[model samples]
Target chain A: MSWLLDNFTLVTELALQHARLSAVPIVVGLLASISLGWLAHRVRAARLIVLTSFSLIFTVPSLALFVLLPLVLNTRVLDERNVIAAMSLYAIATMLRGAVDGFDHLSPGVTRSATALGYSPTGLFWKVQLPLAGPVLLANLRVVSASTVSLVSVGALIGKGGLGYLFTNGFQRNHPTEIVVGIVAVLLLALSFDVVLVLVGRAALPWIRNLGGTSPT
Target chain B: MIEFVGVTKTYDGGAPAVDNFSLRLAPRRITALVGSSGCGKTTLLRMINRMVDPTVGRVEIDGEDIAGRRPVGLRRGIGYVPQDSGLLPHRRVIDNISVVPLLNGATRAAARLRASELMAVVGLDPALAHRYPAQLSGGQRQRVAVARALAGNPNILLMDEPFGAVDPIVRADLQQETLRLQHELRKTIVLVTHDIDEAFLLGDEVVVLRPGAQVAQHGTPADILADPADSFVAAFIGSARGKRRLTISAQRSVDGADRVVVDAGGYPVGVIAAPEGRLPVADPTPRSRGAQVVG
Candidate 1:
């Protein structure tokens, strides 16, 4: 307990750095996934290809993906950027899956009705499809965010900044308190992001709450 | 006015859904396309607004061929309502209704104002405008869909089984509401349904399609009942002709003399005269023997 109180400031700083690392990659990954997913949906023939490629990327072992990035990019001295890249790759897989799921989840009747109502393809995607996909998109965001928070630890192997750094440092120094603090902080961050996502979904997408009160998967 | 000139649609690797169909939908009148499942009634309806383009022939609206026009522009001028309501789940009732107007360049406020008026036009309570589709009942959702179709105030409205997902009572109410709207608005309408009774009730001209999307018959309800083009239509009209006859008889009243009182069984229970001031009691037995009317 004394150990915890003494290193509270150091732990808090590490936690913040970890959150930033997770957040940056998640944001980038989400944007890319949504854009790519929407493109795949608009082009009927590209759906299978886009989905398969993303699925394959997701199947690659996380450690292997991170390890290979430096080799592929022809760079050494893995730093914060390596952490971001590794976390972002992980997030891309989840977000792409989520975006595809959101697109497929839309009722065909709605698309038909939109077309019948004279909505152009663009209008239908923007006004009908995207808005309808909100809950699913938000849920995807939560999953990706949680995954990034946990996976950011892979950065410690390459000497990057985050709570993962604290874990590695504590392991080398034989301090269990630092490792426990890092693990607990990450779990709390993931849970908090999930709760915040739910609240945002409920507030911004009241239809989701009204539709059987089941959050999007 | 909408004209279909030999329109044919063949799904990929499948038989033609609509086979060289040709028909005209007169302005300000309701035309019902009735057929069995996969009979291409829906495919035919979609061609009116170019939701599904014809592979062989052309569809015209207001005497202009819609082939060269951008499908989006063409659709913007035609109101479409489909079965299952098809309201955007995330949008409030009012926003859903305003979709077309917004597409047509109406300001958000203007479109919203029009949407509210349409909500009333379709017989929905004004308070429902703020509710999302998920919050509404099936019947209410269908009403909202109708209201949305009317938002652009287009001269042509196409509905494909718009009331199919609702209960019978709600379906009847929606049909009545559609008729009332037609009376007030006088837009050209084409509706598709599998139910012949619905076609009779709603259509000024009923076109019956066969299994492969061939047109079996096209005529007024009275004419179709009096003389069906073939046995397919006869069977399709079902054994409920007696009830349909009563409805037709009631609608055809001149000087209010066609008095027909039908029981819940749809059999004539009594006959009375109002414009002729004659009240006569007919046989109360159900008319199960023949198609002829007894006075």
Candidate 2:
């Protein structure tokens, strides 16, 4: 407890770094996944190829990925870019499948009617399909966010671990309290991301709330 | 007028869905296409809006080949009501109704204003405009679908089993409402239904279709009922079972004022005012005697 108080500023900076590492991959990966997923959905041939590539990418171990990214990206092993790049790849590998499932679950009637009612292809995607797929998309995003936050801790092995540095240093110094603080901080950060995502989903999709209840008429 | 000239639609080299079907839908009138499932009625309807392009031949609106027009632009100028109402569950009723107007570049306020007016025209309350489609009853949802179709005020309306999803009682009310709306709006409407009775009641001219969209019989309700083209048409209309053949049976009352129209099974169809003076008791063949009382 006294050690945590003494290192409060260092702890805060590490926590902030962890938050950024998690958030960047979550946002960037999801955006990239949405486009790839839509392309997979619209073109029959693209579905097989895109899904296969992502699945293969996901099977690659995270530690190996973090170590290997620096070489492929022409960056130093200790650079933050290697950690961020590795996490972003993992995010996309998971989220691309989620995005496809989100779009696939929409009712055929709604999409058919949209096309028949004069929606251009681009207009239908933005105005109808994507909005309807929000619940599932958000659910997948929550899972991805938590996983990304935890995965960033592995970057500590490469010297870029945000809060993960505590685990390595605490082990070397034989200090269990430092390790516990790091674990607690990561869990709290992941939880906060989950809560924020849920709130965002509810705000964006009002019709999902209070279903079957009638308004005054 | 919408015309299908030698139109034939085939899927993946299989049997033709609509095989060389040609029919002109008269403007400002309702034409009901009555057929069992797989008769290609839906395929034929979709071809008009270019939802499904034909494997052979052409469809034209006012003699202009629809193939020349972009499907999105063509569909905007024509109204389409699908079987499930197809209201966007995420959107409020006003938004669903105003979708097309907004797509066509109307200001949001103007589109919503048009939506509100259509709600009144289709017998929907303004209070219901803020609700989501899932919050409304099945009947109300269908009314919203009809209102949405009319929002653009297109000259043509294509309805594919628009009332088929509701209960029988609501179906009857919607059919009546549709007739009333048609009387006022006078748009060219092509309604697809498997129910022959619905076709007879709502269609100015009903086209009975066999499998593969063959025109089994096409005539006014009265003409088709009175003279079926063949045994298939007779069976399709249920005339072979004497279900559609009604006979007037006068029941005695203190005033002797009501005659019951009954089918062959002796079920009362409806009551009509009794004819003046004595008539043949429970006349069975009134139509040949030129004293028909029921249709």
Candidate 3:
């Protein structure tokens, strides 16, 4: 406990670094996934290929991806870009399936009705389809956010992990408190993210809040 | 008036859904295109708004070829009600109803005002305006659909089995409401249903279609019922069911003030007046009319 108080600024910096690392990949990956998901849905021939590729990427070990991406991108092993890029790949893979499911699970006839009611294709997607898919997308995003925060610590092995440094440093010095502090910080960050996502979801998707099955007419 | 100028629609790998079908639909009347599944009734309706364009030939609305119109612009000017109440589940009833009006460039307040009025027109309560679709009952959702269809105030309303999903009692009520609404609004309505009874009840002129979108028969309900064009029309209208054959079973008084009319299956369908001077319309039943005519 005294160690955490004494190294408070160091912990704060590491936590901030960890939050940034987790956040960038989530936001970037979400945008990419939405685009790819829409393409998968629109282009029937592309659906199987896109989904299979995303699933395959998720199967690669995270440590291997972290090592492999730097080589592919010609970046230094310790470059933060390597971690960001690799985490983004994992985020996209994790959220891609959810994006597809979100769009696929819309109640039947919704898009048909929107088209019939004079919605332009673009307008329908933004106003109706995207908004209705919000709940599912948010749920998957919460998952990605928590995992990314924890995963960023793996960067420590290659000298880039944010709070992950505490794990290796405390192990080397034989001090358990520093390791516990790192674990506690990551857990707090993930929990806060999950809490914030739930709040945003509730605010954004008001219709799903009090929904009951369609009442009998 | 709408005209299908030898329109034909063919998909990628099957027989043409609608093959060289042409028919002129009268203005301000209900024309029901009825057939069982795979009969292309829905495909025929969608061509009006360019949802599915004809592969060959063209559909014309008021002497203008619809193919020339932009699809979004064309659909905005048309009212469409699908089988399920296709209300947006995420939007409240008011927003769903106002969708077309808003698309037509009405201000938010103006569109919602129009939507509220349309809710009354479709027999929906104004109180349901703020409820989401899932919060409403099936009947209410359908009423919202009807109100939404009317939002743009389009002259032509296309219904693809509008009352198909509701219970029979609700369906009958909705059918009657459709009639009442037609009497008031007089919009040119094209309804599609697989049920011949519904077609006869609601359609001013019913077009019975066969599997390949062939026009098996088209005429007033009475004309088609009285003289079926062929065996296909007969079976479609259930002539073999003997439900339409009514007989005067018993006279109630000396003056023939009332008589019980029963169908072939012995179910009382209706009662009729048969005053003394006016001979009861000859019963089609083979049973001697005199024996049943107690008066």
lDDT of the candidates, in the order given: 0.80, 0.89, 0.88
B145-200: candidate 2 lDDT, tens digit per residue: 99998888899999999999999999999998998888777888999999999998
- What is the C-alpha lDDT profile of model 3 across B1-295, one tens digit per residue? 8999998899996799999999999788889999999999999999999989999999999999999999999999999999898989889999999899899999999999999899889888788888898888777788889989999999999999999998999899888888878777788899999999999888888999998789999998888989989989888888767788788886465556777788888888887877753545654322211122211
Give the alpha carbon lDDT tens digit for every residue of B111-172 in model 1. Answer: 99999888888889997787778778888888888888888888888898988989999899
Consecutive 10-residue window with the lowest summed lDDT within model 3 chain A:
A208-217
Model 3 per-residue lDDT tens digits across residues A1-217: 8999999999999999888888899898889889998888778888899999989998998789878987899998889888899899999999998998888887758888899999999999999999988988998999999899999999888887889999999999999999999999999999998898899888899999758855634
- Which prediction has more favorable lDDT, 1 or 2? 2
| Regions of model 2 farther than 4 Å from truth | A213-217, B277-295
- Quote each prediction's TM-score: 0.87, 0.94, 0.93
The collision pairs in model 1 are: none
Identify the CAPRI category of the predicted complex in candidate 2.
Answer: medium
- Cα shift from native, residue B6, model 3 (Å): 1.2
Q: Model 1, A130: alpha-carbon shift in Å?
A: 2.2
Off by over 4 Å in 3: A213-217, B251-256, B276-295
